[model samples]
Target: MAGQAAQIEGIVVKSTGSWYTVFDPATGQRSRCRIRGVFRLRGSRTTNPVTVGDRVKAEIGADEGDNVITEILPRTNYIIRRASNLSKESHIIAANIDTAYLVATLDRPPTSTEFIDRFLVTAEAYHIPSVILLNKMDLFAGPEFREIIDELAGTYRNAGYEVLEISAKTGMGIDELRARMQNKTSLFTGNSGVGKSTLINAIEPGLDLKTGAISDYHHKGKHTTTFSEIFPLTGGGMLIDTPGIKGFGLVDIAPDELARYFPDLFRLAPHCQYYNCTHTHEPNCAVTAAVAAGEIAGSRYVSYLKMLEDDDKDGKYRK
Candidate 1:
């Protein structure tokens, strides 16, 4: 009977509330598993007790094949946001991600720069490398839209992030995009209608994940992917696709520590006149000066100020 209690280690590929799909690399097998009732995530106060991309250990049931997760291994890093419509709690997006790809669109469902920066700040705080994927290039062919796309790409690229211009419709820049994701575990995320699933289907054809259309009246995307799931790429890496999020609220970040998440702002902050400059109304603030000098992107500073407002009003980062 003791021998029957063998343990198997696996990576969580999908999470659906009470059930998780774990993939065992050694035997190339998959199993549906549930965690022990007493188990809790060590560090995060997440809505889900377990998240996709988590490494875990489980014991297979003898009579029924359903497994019981006995342990949730420590995560190297994870990306999270305030729980949807729940201000007091947070939701874990994905764990142990090597990189996060934030897909943005210029039209059909415009992605605000504020949204982009908030995501970037969260990625910075979690120590996850982030790449800006400017998708739907085909829609940005007009001269005016082209300028906007170019400037947006240049802004992030100058801020020390890799920005790729891709079109899931036309297959533009797909090879380059695929090359970067070859050996890394990447998490693909963005607002709904930004074509996260479409991009993945282009990168790896057979998945054929569902796609959705934007609301004509609100010009917003409808949620298509309901849960986060991880898939192994044929090219030697893994990818985590997350449900589209309407807003990315910062969690556990204070007003003072917020600037540290913005690379450009953090670099210039030490030069501020006041040691504790919030950069809001402080005299001789270097960050504000940079903004005036056009050294810092104005849109970025606006996003920062918006976050500060949220912090002041409720102490939680939310749109």
Candidate 2:
């Protein structure tokens, strides 16, 4: 009885399938733990039963090596996407996030608008406030690139998202970004080459997270962050860094309700003739009218249509 383990409450800071690193706020100690058997049979459909940013209760063994997570506390919110193009299961990216920062790039392994929209849709569905961080501003010096950047910023801004044009390499918008991240749990995610890790390193220099180069042949970013992990910020918040994702498939969202997640489309849906306008072909659809009127960005509309059609085999919308 003297050696019996005691239960402790902590946050799951890192997850690598079989093992989790739980960080206790009270003791500032992290314990490597495995989940109890019942967790696997809890009827949850996600690929991982326990994900980073999850608050959990675990038993700290006397030897410390046999710690077992016993319970997952209720989450305030979480971002989820289909686990794979061919799989039905979902993958919870992170839970209890205060803000979701989607780092995007115009070129050097360009992050597609569809991918951006999809990620925003998921964030909207979960009621998580999202900020679009347009990284690599230093490279967009040419007139053509500048025009593209302006249009991209305007498109999302009009759709009601805060778009920050930042150069993680040059510290252009790092201060503002850091200010926004203060005292909040933020999730930094994006396509492989969008500089999520580099940006984080710029914000918290001490982290020095590993970064990768763009594939010259494909112009895509090589995966750098292998797993999801949460880090305490020197300023006043926590950050969850995840592996670069290639495709973000919508999970648990009905086709009919997809438009609600798109802020611009949702605002115009009320003016449509039909109560349940798919915004595809409904007569007098305000969404289509807005598109034709240039009130909504064509690129965003195209992304919506693609998601509605659900035809992309790998869930990666290509130009």
Candidate 3:
């Protein structure tokens, strides 16, 4: 009942816990409606249950000019994060996205490579194409942060990804990013201070989302986006901007298969003798050998090991 993507009627554009803003296809109108009572108490959904991109059937009240969510449609693919609760359920981030943008900053409020790796691994596991967006190019002060950005871009690109360096302040690479968004759904995500809002304004300026400045004293961004919102791009496709995430715990991967998601690591995994090698202590392990030979970025490898450790401790529940 909860996971099916019903193609019978409308699209869910907004989710506010108790209600969903749905765009009806027949009448070409949008309305806010609560989920059926049975659907709410079903408790099958982990986080708010229905995400913003869900397509569902809405039955309008006879001559009442309103509707209620009757049935949810099945999803082709859904992006999920570990739920923030003791129960440890899976929280769906969004459904049916074309690509996921992990917007990052090189200097101020530096996004740890560990954070980036976790998000990337999760995307890989879910078969989602992901791109790393290096934002705030105008603020690159010196060789250190600049070199770091270059290294990050090279690391991901070598691992077979598209990386775009942009400056929300100077309007540098927004065109390249927008060209990719043409006629496809995209999810813009990053740490709190990486200027996600600023970049969105520069790209489509009409949305005018509340942009927050990072606190100079602490180098942290204030929470400007309270909830995940879906906005239509100029011609086609959609952009779902989610609240800044402090940590991303992958929900459903095993320790043995952890190396498979890291594209760099998986490339070398075939040489290992044991098909199920964990790489921590496996003899003749190709993954470890690549690590020693500098074939893979050390930071990404470290993140992989940490995810294995977490999987051992918490099983499939996202922390």
Candidate 4:
């Protein structure tokens, strides 16, 4: 059957622009494949047509080195953000993730609430489970810093999210992270300098993914993990590692729907005076009242407003 096209099914483990590394399900063989010219992501304006964690069908010829990916199977879910180059378009980070672990840090390039909230909103929009991983806990040496970290952790945990305080350098709480990732395809994402790669190495040693130091001058993480790649966790799961994100602009979501993604806000939305309250200037707004009454975190309310600002007609936060 040399003349017959050798069709095979596999999952895309790595995406480096034009070439994709797909792993064979049956034989565990990896084939470097290129997308067929006519294939495109349906209803998507993303830069890359395919991303890591996507199941695909490819035709392997006599030389498996140059297989052509013919089709992408239906994805259960995918996480995306605004592409850096294209303002209107987006970039799919990873697909079919059972859980998205957001790695955050309190010092040496601290993670902001706006970034965390935007990410959580996106995850909420896609119905993907999100877990917050607070790395660099060892840096919380002083009682003041420890209080800040503990308060931040409490804020999220109260919002119905699972927050794990970890220090990859010291292996603190890495085991718990591993246990949570067991038998699940988890997407590890975070801002630069938040220790995403270091945590991965700690979770599964020898991978030694190239990691860079946080720039002391700028206090930001230097870009590492240039492309999206998936690694099989020794604990019977998959972890997709993504490049450090500087910003996570929401895409494919509308302004009116933003409040619904915030669980705490949504719960109080129905009690507002106006049925179509924007929660900004609307009188007797339950959301704002909750924010004032100390029932909701003021930082979260600010994040919601920032997203709303981006959705404004002349909003400048789109990027």
Candidate 5:
């Protein structure tokens, strides 16, 4: 007891499965910490007990090296998805985020609309504000690419999301992105090859986050950011950079409640004849009517139906 360390509060800036890097804002010091005891969330089984952006109570020993995280503070909100298509456990991408910026690309390992929808749905379920950053705008020189980007932006805009066209390689929309991220905790996530690390590096070049290249043969991005870590931005806020996710599988959301998460569909659900409409085959379904009338994007409706079917079949909705 003579050499025991007192309890101190800090933020978990990085998690590498077995150890966590806890940063104390008071002292501006980071200590390598390990879990002091078994910790688990009430109803869910999470793969990692501690994740980036989590505020925890840790003990820094007298020598100031052997730090042990004792507790994880309650999270205001977090983004979660199934750990895998076959695993029942959920993985929290980041906790207590002020904004979630999903970096998407239309070419070179294109980010599918379904994948975007899935991410938005998860954000909606968690009540987190989401912005779609269409990176690699410099590639849209031809009219064909321009049209595609325009349509994609319009689709998300019509659904009540702000879409920003950005080219990370050329600093096209980095200023606006920097302003938006100022003084807030922002999470950047997307499929591999979407340039998440590149964008972050551009936003804060001093960070010099590692960037990877796109595979020529497969047109996929090799993983560069292996673990989640939080960085202090020079612009007065924090950022949580996570590993590039290949698929986002829905977790903890029921089939009947799925529509509520899709903002476009949820707006039209009330007009349906039945109070509880799956929006699949019920007569006078407002959602179906909107889809047929071209009020809703056909691709979004397809994604919704696909999620429903997946949930109905095996309760595993992966995209």
Candidate 6:
């Protein structure tokens, strides 16, 4: 047996860089540990070597100090993104997520539609069921605000997803959200300042996740929650709250295959000509035609193309 694999069995509840905080279920002890060098890089394109929600076997040191993670069990599914260093590599966000909650805000943070679409496409690529939660319903006091919410909720629902408008401040729609989350390990993700931490605090008060305000100058958000950490919900399931991600760099997905991630694009791509249409300039391209005829959102096709171009001509992602 490897020297590192001789200790305890536990689930990784937190991951920062290569350091993981694993909880030993048997003893209920959480130890901060580093993974074996074998797992470092090891051909993973992501910036992070390990991810939250990993099932790992940890070995506590002789002094009962910091432990070392010896092995990582297989994950059912994981969400990954491009590394932030602009190296064209990837980073594993979270693993073994039963469901993902796409939290967005209309008033304070104003989550972009392109961001939501890109995330949804990525979720589809990972085979994760995602539900959109438009937070801060209490702040949308005007009719115009309500109309936009309805339209967004309707758009996602029409795309074969479940969307709900909730007020983490006023407790609106929190019950339904809680019901759906019962007994499920859910991952909450969105742009910064979209009230992700606030909503989690409202739902599971004991979590006490740090929350930050949206930047008024850049009209963006600042990172409040640092590192990804999984918290056990008092109601039953687990919720993983990740740091506010400013950019969601997609990883590994090739350009030619990018359309497959978009449900609407995939549904209509088979009709294009040339059997392997790149959908750029190919004649009789159903995707291009759809774009021209307003069948597909131009923004989405552009985002797909961006992903493809970012993949480089080598047909792989690695900066």
| Candidate 5, position 222, lDDT | 93
lDDT of 4 by residue, 91-155 (tens): 88999999999999886888899999999999999989999998888888668787787789888
Query: Between which residue pairs do clashes occur in model 1?
Result: none
Model 2 regions lying over 4 Å from their true place: 1-3, 311-319
Lowest lDDT sum, 10 consecutive residues, model 1, at: 310-319
* Per-model TM against the reference: 0.93, 0.94, 0.89, 0.94, 0.94, 0.88
Segments in model 4 whose C-alpha atoms lie over 4 Å from true places: 1-4, 41-44, 84-86, 314-319
lDDT of 6: 0.79
Model 5 over residues 10-53: C-alpha lDDT tens digits? 99999998889989999988898887546755433888767889
Q: TM-score: which is higher, 3 or 6?
A: 3
Q: Which is superior by TM-score, 1 or 3?
A: 1
- Model 4 lDDT, residue 10, Cα: 93
Residue-level lDDT of model 2, residues 1-319, one tens digit each, is 6569988999999999889999999998999999877877773687787889999999998766679998899999999998444578888899999999999998897898988999999999999999999999899867878788889999999999999999999999999888888899999999988999888888888997899999999999889789999888885899888999988988877777888999998999989999977787668999999999998999999989888778444533333
Off by over 4 Å in 6: 1-6, 41-44, 64-66, 312-319
Residue 82 lDDT in candidate 3: 74
Clashing pairs in model 3, backbone N/Cα/C closer than 3 A: 4-73, 4-74, 5-73, 5-74, 6-73, 6-74
What tens digits encode model 1's per-residue C-alpha lDDT throughout 152-244? 887787678888888999999998878888988999998998999899989888998898888999877899899788878886999888898
Q: Please identify model 1 stretches exceeding 4 Å from their true place.
A: 1-3, 41-44, 63-66, 84-86, 313-319
CA lDDT scores, all candidates in order: 0.85, 0.88, 0.79, 0.87, 0.87, 0.79
Clashing residue pairs, candidate 5?
A: none
| Residue-by-residue lDDT tens digits, candidate 6, 1-319 | 3344348989999887857898987988988888776887584555666789889888887543557888888989999876442667777889999999989888578887767877887898889889898888888868877777776666566567788888988999887777777888999998888888888888887777888877878766688888888988776888889887766767666676777887777777789986877777778989789879866766667777666666567844222
- In model 4, the number of clashes is 0
- Candidate that beats the other on TM-score, 5 or 6, i.e. the better one: 5
Which pairs clash in the backbone of model 2? Answer: none
